[model samples]
Target: MRIVVTGGMGDLGSRVVRLLVEQGHEAVPASRRTGLDLTTGAGLEAALAGADALVHCADDPSQGDFVTVYGTRRLADAAAARGVHLVHVSIVGIDDHPMAYYRRKLRAEQGIQAAGGPATVLRATQFHSLTAFFARTLTKGPVTFTVGDTAFQPVDTDFVAARLAELALGPRPTAYARATDVAGPDVLSLVEVARLVRAHRGASAPRAIRVPPVGRLMHAYAESRTVPPPGSADVGGRTFAEWLATQPARLTGR
Candidate 1:
């Protein structure tokens, strides 16, 4: 099978491409690096030619809703024209949310459904990398600012990618793949998370400041939006602690 992966150079996209190639499938990596600009539709004709299936993983930074919604519509139309199957990766709870990004994702899903092509929409929880990135970015010297009481179910990128590849090969099903309730094996407040990270690195303790709107969102997430129930079939492995343990050691710049 010839599989084309958009945003193939991205963190998740690269994993999908590698998985497909390892599975003995013809994997075409289409990204800006490969001269395939998904936002502009450049090189799409050549990139998608002869593609049996596609994993649409393209993302626009700065919350470009139009690019994500409309760009995906174009991609779906092109896939339909080529008679190729599509596997769309989206965030969990998108269908129930009114957020701009989530709304755009819903529109993308609708576009794919309207394309009249075989399609599978896989909505996954946040990635562990995203959580880690947030953790690192929110830290300032010895203080970490965070949305207090927020919950997250962050799955491993590799697991998500593998599941995507499996979905790409299997029959189309509107299935949702969630990650383990990834709260470091414990549900801790933002302050607790900051403390844990500081203790893990043997660094000085940091103060955790909870902001307002973000904290409200976090509270909502903790209430019901995030954290899957135990033994849920949709959830997969690697508790947050396990995921953190797997992270590569940091290097001090010389």
Candidate 2:
């Protein structure tokens, strides 16, 4: 099968491409770097010309809805016209989230459904690196400030990528359908996460300070909106600590 992965050079997309290749599939990366620009629809038709499936990992939250929403719609339409299966990765708990990027992601899902094509949307929790970044950011010297009961159930990037590859290789859906949400095996509180991060760098655990949820966004996080409900997701991935151990002591951006 010939699979085209948008943003294939990215951290996630690159992994998808590599796995697809390892599985004996023709994997082509389509991105601005490869002469394919989703925002402008440049090289889109050509990219999907002989593609049996397309994995959409290309998103630009910074560009507002132009790419995240409209760009996705354009790609969906093109894939639909070509009868190519479209696999899109989305975040968990975006149905009523207040975050702008999550809203756009939801809108992108809607667009794919509206295109009336064979598509699969896979929702996964935050990546381990992102979770670590959050832990680092919220920690101040020897203290970590967190909202009411804020916690994260971050998933492994490789795990998510492998699932995307499986979907692309499996039977094409008849229409827009959602795959089971994927997440990590354990849920850790913000403070616990901070402790793990500090310990990764041989630093002492920070004192935890819990504050009110305050505001809709913080409240949403405080309620653990990012985590899927009990028994509501397919949980399989390296634990946060396991993933952290493989990373550099000094963590960088997500």
Candidate 3:
């Protein structure tokens, strides 16, 4: 099958494309890098031509609201017109949350559902890379407290890519790949995550302060979201420690 992956040049999208290619599918990566601007529907027609399915991975860094909501609508419309299947990669807990990003994702889901196209929605947890990005940015002079105690199930992006490829070839079903509430294979407070980073990087240990309210919504996520049971098929094997090991080398170009 020929699959067109929007945002194909991005970290997640690139992984999806590579996995599809490895699975013996013709994967066309369409993005601004390839002259396809999903927001305006430019260069899409030619990019999508002869494609059997579309993996909608396009994202707008500054304005996720416009891109996720409207951009998805346009893609859905085009897919319906062409009678192509769509595999939508979404974030977990989008419908239950009211965040701007999450709301836009919900809108995208609605758009795909209403388009009457063969579609599948796969919502996964945050990627380990996202956590590493936060860790790098929020740490300042030996203390990091912005993330608070909120829970996160950070998955390996490669694992997510593989699951997306599988979905692309299978029947359309709304599937949620619940990542192994993946922490360092051990439950840790926000402080601990920071401490681990400091130790790994050979930096001075930073004090981790707990902020009040710490954003209750995030707290709810931390408490409930990272509790997937043992042996669940939805869980991936890579641990947070393994993810962290790769980060320092990648960051330092070592």
lDDT (tens digit, per residue) of candidate 3 on 2-112: 999998888889999998888888999998889887779888799889988898888885776667888888888888788787888887666566456777888888888
TM-score of 3: 0.83
In TM-score terms, candidate 1 sits at 0.80
For candidate 2, give the lDDT: 0.95
lDDT of model 1 at position 135: 64
Task: Check candidate 2 and list the clashing pairs.
Answer: none
Superposed Cα deviation of residue 164, candidate 3 (Å): 0.5
Candidate 3 C-alpha error for residue 147, in Å? 5.9
Clashes of each: 0, 0, 1
Quote each prediction's TM-score: 0.80, 0.99, 0.83
Please, what are the lDDT tens digits per residue for candidate 2 over residues 1-254?
A: 99999999999999999999999999999899889988899998789988999999998888999999999999999999989999999999999899889999999999999999999999999999999889889999999999988999999999999999999999999999999999999999989999999999999999999988878999898999999999999999899999999999899887
Best by lDDT: 2
Q: For each candidate, what is the lDDT?
A: 0.70, 0.95, 0.71
Candidate with maximal TM-score: 2
